[model samples]
Target: MAKKWFLAANKKQTDGNRMEAPQRINASDGINTSASLETLPHVLFADDDANMREYVSCLLKTQYRVTVVQNGIMALELAKTTRPDLILSDIIMPGMDGIQLLQALRQDPRTHDIPLILLSIRASEASKIDSFDAGADDYLVKPFTPPELLARIKAHITLKRTRNQAYQAIKSSEELLQSVFNGVPSSIAVYKTCYAADNSIDDFEMFLLNDLMCQSLNRPKHDIIGKRYRELFPTASKLDVLDLFKEVVYTGQSTSFERWYETNGKNRCLRFKANKLHDLLIVIADDMTAEKQLQIKNEQMKAKQLEMEARQQREIFRVTLRTQEEERRRISENLHNGLGQMLFSIKLNLDTIDLSDSLFSTEENRKKLKNAELLLANCIRESRRISHELMPSILEDFGLEAAIENICSQLTGPCNFVAEIEPIVPPADQEIQLAVYRIVQELALNIVKHSQATEASIKIYDSNEGFINATVSDNGIGFDIQKEDNNATGLLTIKHRVKMLRGNIHCSSQIGIGTAIKISLPKTIDTY
Candidate 1:
């Protein structure tokens, strides 16, 4: 029946004068094939029936560049040589059957991807299944419509072209990726995880290496690619970095580490980061030696600068202390030589006079003697007060707390004073003790003279953290801290002294509220 239908198709094509030869059809066939027809997709047709071949060629010639063969063997040879976009074959052939041709084409690497359509008179499910099992892309019965054949050929060719285009794009992308990987600034390497029998990642094999990575390893790509990590780097086992790589693969997490790496006898700091990509591990390495060395040099320079500043400060403090001692010595000398001699002379003259026998015990003369004695005593008391004011001798005789207490007792004006001082254990060094005393003295004087406060208090104690803390507060009218003039001369002097002793001072005040001054000094000063 199929042969009768083919004969009828051939008769109709002959009546229309469209019958073609049962051989290859191309531009060189002298059929006036246009250049556009040559660019059309090529289709290979195989069938033993001559009328069917002519009819199929007449149907497809207008749309495709058709090549007709007498048998599957000829079709396979033509497909292999021409590499047609699609193949159409009849199952029952003389030499190689359509199924056998499909298998052969699928086995050959050159023609494996070409689309194949199997045509057979047997429309049973078994035949169709056999054709598909042989890698036939499509299957059709012998008596099919021309539209169906044309549509099938067009669809297969379109799909094949799409696949080819996609393959070309993928290849281009791979080449671009390889170029970028090699051109990257940092070192990079890829490894494929090699698993053990227990499904655990035991080791890694070198998969890909970039240019910088090759240079860093001091080896070429061919020498390292596909080599086991341990075989290439035996020392890595001792470092146990393989566990890190395994962790990345098993956990699918990224990790990073930094270490000092020595290569070619030079030590360098290298930072490594590993990322998991499916079963592959991508490790990126960066050289941090320059940055680390710069940091170390900066730290050393900063330390030296700090030391130099400390020495300069110590020298300034020493010079200032020496000058203060000299001034005190001069004041002491004046008081002792000039004032002491005058007071001594006055006492000697008074002792030389006998008060009981003076002026024969007359009331006027005795009153006069009493008045002169009171005047002489007043002068002596005033001279001693002046000397004590210059340098508190009580501070030397008694301890710091007692000296401060004596100072508090001397607050004679309207404002009251209180002292909360702790006994210095082991006693502070003389310089610190004096500095504390002077700071308290200056702050106290400032409060009395300027603060117009009715009440004031001074506190001194050990912070128990190697510091001596002092706070002086007053319930007086405060002033704006932002004003420069508000920082009085006495406060400036206190600040200078505190700085020399390596101390910190904080002054807080408000317009209506009182003022508070707190000072902290280190218990031990590092002169060097």
Candidate 2:
């Protein structure tokens, strides 16, 4: 006969006193149980015998919060819901016995970590072996002492709790690392170095690529990861990008540089930094194509603006030359017509008076008439000279060459001025012809007044390069051309006229030596 098991339960005594049931603390309530209650781990007990279930639950409740079930099936279901710290199930039951329950619980991630112990009346080695093979943490025989059962439960529960805490810490650390990796804006990649048979690093295999790197490459993570550098970007072999990775790995130093690549029918400029971590290489890259393009555009705009400004300045100079030429023509006409006519009429009226005739026939009257005629003649010559100086009609009628020769013949100075003019046709543009003639005239005057030289020469010739070149030289006391004051209006006017003709002038002079001025003007001006 089997022994009947008796266990304590809540009941009323004959003296009307109530027996207290063991306290049931709900671990999920988050209640701050006493230190003794906090130490009480939750346990699930399963058995086919009602008496045995009651007997064990009563004893285990003193040390642990106990939940009892009728069979292994009930025990497995309750274990999943409560996620108890430990499970104790009978080896033999009507269905889904202890070994089967252990296998099912171990297969589930939720209950696999819960420490399990097997209890049965069959203490055979085969039964024990089956319990351990099915993933039992501990096994015990029937009618075991309460102390032994409590000790085993405590040990396994402590171990399980320790492992759970360690797993949580590692999960938190991984989450933090993932956040940092995704937060960076630049494209980043990590590669593991691969070597050739000769032990030299030949290539690299991708270990990790951040989201930005995938987007930059226009490839998915699955396609990029575990791919060789050259395989993913065949063009990289031509660019020798793998060399950069090898250098970083071998030297244990970081390097940065700019590179250009053509992708998807567009050019991209990237600034890259490469560093090595043992056998792995880390690369960070930023796209700089937009920045470079903007800089190039700005430079183009500046050049265009400078060109426009130069055109405007030339236009202003052309208008000024036209106005000056018109004013000179007006002054020349006034001097030649109005003033010359008046002087000529005065001379004719004087000539009409007969000093030799009767009225006086005195020596003093004849001498006075002769003096008056000389004064009128001088006035008439002065008027004509002023008109010619204001605007040389010879320049317009006979061209630049004839005008130069005429001016040279009319020089009334100690300087022996000579002209070696080339008989080229005058420029088609009247403005150009006038500018060249005026520049030469100013140069000749400067030589006469400032250069106390005995000999001066002017040469005008056609250069082979579609330009007319003129040079003026004098053997005289040359002044410092650099130190010449702004008040030197004659030289300044010469420079201004040359500029108007789109010509260039160079003046060289030294004290006690000689002065030479060279001018070159293009034959045709660009009107556009």
Candidate 3:
């Protein structure tokens, strides 16, 4: 397997004259690293030699943005943040060297899969093997011709793109698995777990799924519940998979892999993983058997769908739904589990203390009583905030407009709240209302949190699609939407929920100017 390498790009793609490849010091091919259909191909190049970085940059500039770092420390730092499509590094330098950098990257999930291409003057067979053992995606001999290096790059890049495209095609081919719960048609051993009320994964009721999951392992989920990845999959030899999972969990990045193994004594490869929509792991597997044949019609349909919508919108929708559910669960639990208990205790104390008793009668006792009452009031306010954040209780009592009005008034930012709800939105469905409110809430939070502007506006007007349009705008510094990092998980969640409401969310932002989010959603019947 080629060691994961990464490339850095400033723009989506470069445009210029296609210069011949620069003379190379070293390069190698990768086996386990490449781009996926769901993610764009990114890359990073590192070298202490400014001339070399520039030369390589000039040669690859048309295809990739060449990041020139003074040393490996900078490379590692940039790699964590940029997560380029590929990594091209130099073998020797001050502070951190390529070998050390590669080792660190291997240990970090964010950079592990990036195809790493090493460059240096001391190129030998032994050195090449050492590079491979250390996990270089490709190794090129020093003083090598530009043509040869480019050929190798082309081959490795080509192989990776091919593999990912095949995996995506397979996934699209099997989209009918969209039916939730009855079965995924995919090889998922789901039994039942005590799913959290907020739908976040509190604990997997492994006992129920024990039989199904362990049927593959001959071991139960109990043994694997808190177990490490290496214990679960002896085949996961690369540290990258372990490192990757941690990064995914910590940073909320979605990663996928294709695993090939023998099932039923037959060799098969599975569309192993997909974006983490919620607590559930989305996976797909198909048999490569002669008897288990797929119809030509089905294949045609899969290919067509893959070519068409690809359900990228659905992916976004699922992520948003899962995020909202998770957020609600967290906030509710904080209230119910934390503030709720405290408030209950305070209420009990109040009830137990008789107003007619001596403790309540004295002038000093009265002051003490008044202070206790104030403390209890604060706790009540905290609980109310938590509940409102979760699912404004008022939204149910009154309609969406009144609830939103209350929310706007409570918003602590300096911006004044202004709203226009015609006929007061005519009581849209619960899901639709929640979606709109949540979107508005998140937008408001962003303004309070990031946008350093003074005032903003909110309007809910009817659109031609028989849906309402909610617009939020501010005069804050805007960011490049395309440049938003994959680590911007919050934005992804927002995008997802908008999709769930069968709505369209469009954002227009300009640096030093301002930002605007226009949400157009169809009105659905109430979920509550």
Candidate 4:
């Protein structure tokens, strides 16, 4: 009088309102599944009771391709060949039960990781522990509801699929990494430290050498691998590479350096990077011979260019000193010729104009006195002109603008000098101001002396580009700046002054057209 038990099938109802039959499996023929069920995961079930097997097959067939066997012997035999996604078996049977099947599955390499669930009529804690000890992934007591059984089955199947996917991904990644490590252009090697009897590092034995390493060293892998570093390169100590390897191993700090390596009678620059990996040292090297050669060539060119600039500057300095000496000689000549004669004549006239002399008539004496007074006035004007030429008094009193204006007014030649000077805040350094004034003075005077122009103009302004700009131009026949600038001492003097102020000068002139000289000085003193 045992109760008959059956669970309703979960398969979709057909047009005739009947459930589909559960799929059957054979060891030789495999599962006899429909085309629609071909993609479902395979499930293997083992139990001695016919009712339990029938119920489970019907319950799981809708979601899985179900295969039912009589006991663990059949289940284990089929699992070895077919490799189902999951297995469910009843624990208690006549012989070859679920516990024994699980042990066998766990021991087999092919079935070790398959998800298995055990079922038992006896719900004792001892039975559950025994099932788990036998390597069952999950345990279910008899008379469990269909929902609970299906949920457990779904979770285990999903977990197994996820784990398989992860394993495949990791395997593919390792393959890709190995391919890159072998194929990279840089040379790579790994070395394990060999210790002497005293426990101090004696040498490093080659643990790994990539293909590039062998090619770079011009040695085959068989010759390089497992060879000690000192044995491979007797001159490693001279190169300092072996010492760097030891430092990285002892201090656990990475080191990178470049060295000249001699190979096949050719010297090449190679850059090496060494890092410690536990008890091993990893080194990567790159051929930098070409880059290093190019860098050295550039440095040589730069040095040559700097030397030429220095020579030019020295020449300018020599010319500047010579110009100052000529200027002083000219001033001395002017004083001796112009002022000295006038003063001597005035002294003679004063000596004759003594009021005690009776031979001197009133009108005659008045005239001689007037002539002496005119001579004295001429000497005073000559002295003042020389003082102004040395350093303009107006410049010191009124800054750069007023100084330029005074020079414009004093221009005595046929050229009409016009000034357009902006009122700017004077620079903190008086030397800079003096340099600017001299530049303007040289340009204006050169226009009058060389350019036979009727009109000349000068402009000075503070530019928005952070510079003080000055320009001088004339409406007269001009000369080739390249040809004349080097020859003209006046222009040379202007250039020297401009250079001292760290300023730029541009002179543009055509044969028939007028000439314009423009100079720009940085407002900030340190810009040069």
Candidate 5:
């Protein structure tokens, strides 16, 4: 059978125009060529001799699914269409030799990855080298045993399967990583460092940009990707961003910082965190413009509030001093006009009387003396009344409760006034006691002069928490507190007194209904 196959090959060469029939090898040569039980790896075998095709197919049938092609042309076509797991071809063929076929398969992407082996009759070093150069994965010499053929085929097929699985795993991992990078809320980007002639990093080229990064720059990915930092942002040099990235890369450490930039005529603040990732640098940025603006606004508000409070305090002090001066002036005028005139009258009457006039010398003379004596007594009483009104010594001598009760008894008008004074110890601080007395006096005067109420009540009591609470209410023609001028001298005095004591007061009034004034003062003032 071997001799016949050789004879056919020689005749095919002589018939230059028409090819001779190739010999075929039959399984009847004591080889068990049964079909494989499981799914088998595909193999494409190419050879010009029909006998060699049949022999190789019969040998591999039990372990693999074999496709026999008569020449390299048929083998190449079958390999591309079927995408076989392995290809076995003879070096010598009638059309398109194995070396040329191997080169063609390697160039085509679809069939390039398929494992290929070359079968040759020539065993010279040149031929083996030529096969490998043409991209053959394995080579076998002619007259090789079936065992050797099966082993080589199994080894190549197993290797191809393992390589394919690894490629798939790597692809999947890359896809997962991409998903996570883009899914983050902040802007994330990857950059490749570009170095100058001196081996120092001069610039950076954008390698990857997530969706948020693209949006933050207000540019599309295609425009930003593969572009240098300066190209994307003309002002990058001023920001010194290249220096920051270089520092991180050189130190192999992570750093975070804040940066401000102007984009589309609006200022923006960004907080950036950078770290080195092997040959690339990764940056994550958050937009802090809104937060920074809010902080600035809050600071402005606080400053304004402080200024207003200081102004109000100054105004209160000025008003208080002015009110005290006006009270002193009015008191002085009253003393000079009222008591001083009466004293002059008494002096004149005494001067007219005789130095040693006998008692009852004449009826008219006695009457004049009695009248002069009465005038003297009246002048003395007037002087005492004016002095008491000025300071109300009752407050210092009898305590706050007695002073309040005495003031209430003096309220005589069309209104029926009631005083509910709780018995309690006077405050230790003279200033506190005076403050409470003045507050009550102001409220009672306001109700009597303005309120025109039929009934009025005054309440003074000590709280368990070391506070004095005073309330004065009247059923009068009430006034709208909101519409009333708060800077009125009377209300201003009340407010200033309350503030001085570090106390609080509330005045509630409604037109034509009633008015209620509540004041709370601490028992002791803090000196410090």
Candidate 6:
């Protein structure tokens, strides 16, 4: 006779229930189900946006244990300590974004295998390219509906579980079915018969039972030895879930559950997995209740943050434009006060010498007059150069269009310059104008200094965005942008200027390939 064995449940060991069930179901299916299942596997999510975290977390919670954190720092700490089964992180965040965090984790052998995903609204083709370049297992674009997020998570989790092979202690293949069934950490009571294959599990059991299998469930050891699990789960006595567990045993694969339910007046919902052992169904469940709520709040928070960021960017852009305009003003003042007057004085003296020559006679005097004229010519050229350097006079009231033409003329020394622009400023935000000017200036300088190219273009056009955009593309030997820039202020300067304009700066260059500095600045009252 199999000795009837049962042990009382222990809730104190649950650490003051700091991780109590997140869902509360009327425990009145009403039996004292003190037999807690095993602890659930841990998963960590790092996303700056609270709302994204909420959606992903809630979806994942249905099947696996989940933990959603605000940023990479918490994700790292959680991964190091709790050693979650998987880690899902969004790329960009406030303190420490996903890329940096992933690098750190990978460096430490402890958290290397954990998978990282970048979740962001930066879904443009270029942005996607950048995210993958930064070392990510996968990338999730922003505005992803809950179903899409859930599907991606499921694919990754399945991959992770398949990759992870925990050592099993069951005996021979003969007892494989029962042994696998009973080996899980849930209060699963698998019946001896089943007709379904491993892949198709009964829908209801697929959900609840999987949650029960995650490690979060707690149960006494002896109570499971001989007692029928339904005895402990009186309300579930009517549930004939035995067949699903049996299928898992026969298939050597696993069954899953994703759901929300409240029991014992305690809210609990989690992801779970069940595999069969010789005569029992080994059950495991995750605690998802907390993760779901957190994911929701997180997503909401993220939405607000994105809106705030957009506004800030607009403001920064406006400030930068104003700054550039001030710079232009200063340069204009210098040209007028110093260079302009000096050139004018030289012109006047030459004019007087020519007029006086008509009244005087003598070869020596004529030669002297010629010398003065030549000197005046030099002064005029120098003044023009100075004026151009301070501020391109063409760009003053004319805006960015004519200024680019001047830049093209100057670059003619080494490379043939091509310039184009649309002439229009709707009192156009100054930041866009300045950013376009500065960014173009820097790219040209870099080409002259490093690109070793002989040709370039400063093209500008306007679209419905009501914004001025510029691109300085050069046909020069390009260099790797990814190379570490310990002191590369040139690129940084360009980037800063773009940031200030609440604009974007993009550089695409590779060894032997030409480089292009593409910039887009919003023309509105946006801040950085």
Q: How many pairs collide in each candidate, listed in order?
A: 0, 0, 37, 0, 1, 84
* Candidate 3: regions farther than 4 A off: 1-298, 301-365, 424-427, 486-489, 525-528
Arranged by lDDT, best first:
4, 1, 5, 2, 3, 6
Worst 10 residues of 3 by lDDT: 1-10
Q: Which portions of model 6 show Cα errors greater than 4 Å?
A: 1-384, 423-427, 486-489, 526-528
**Higher-lDDT candidate among 2 and 5?**
5
Query: Per-residue lDDT of 401-505 in model 3, one digit per residue for the tens?
Result: 887677677775676656666653454667777878877887887787787877777787776556778888888777788875822636677776676556788
lDDT of predicted model 2? 0.78
Clashes of 1: 0
In candidate 1, position 408 carries an lDDT of 86
For candidate 5, the 10 contiguous residues with the lowest summed lDDT are: 17-26
TM-score, structure 1 vs. true? 0.45
Given candidate 2, what's the lDDT at residue 18? 52
**Candidate 6 residues 1-528, lDDT tens each?**
001100011132245533222232233543212331124445688877665565455556545567899988888888898777667777777788877887888788888777667777677888777767766677887645445666676677667666664323222432574455456554443333223466543222221222233223344434333444444344443544445555676687788875565556566665657776554455555567788889978999999999898887776576557657866896687677766666676565555553345445445457656766675776677677776665666667677776777777777777788988776556456655665776787677667877778888888877556666787888788877887571153675566666755677777886776888788777776533
**Model 1 accuracy (lDDT, Cα):** 0.82
Tens digit of per-residue lDDT, candidate 1, span 41-128: 8999999888788878878877778899989888888888999989999989888999889999999999999999988889999988
Model 2, residue 215: distance off in Å is 5.8
Please give the ranking of all candidate structures by TM-score, highest first, separated by commas: 5, 4, 1, 2, 3, 6
lDDT of each: 0.82, 0.78, 0.65, 0.83, 0.81, 0.63
The weakest ten consecutive residues by lDDT in model 1 span 17-26
User: Which candidate do you rate higher for lDDT, 4 or 5?
Assistant: 4
TM per prediction:
0.45, 0.41, 0.37, 0.58, 0.64, 0.34
TM-score for predicted model 6 compared with the true structure: 0.34
Q: Candidate 1 at residue 221, lDDT?
A: 85
Report the lDDT tens digits of candidate 5 across residue range 1-528.
434645554565478624323233345653334443236788999888887877677667766778999888988898889999999998888879999899999999999999999988789999899888888999998766556788899999999999999999987886787789889999998999999999999888998878888888889889999999888777768887778989999999999999888876778898999999997999998999999999889999989999987897888888778888877887777777877776777677666766455654455566667887787787788777777676779999998878888778787578877889886565547878787787788778777888889899889888767778899999998877776584462887787778767788898888888988888888777631
- Top of the candidates by TM-score: 5
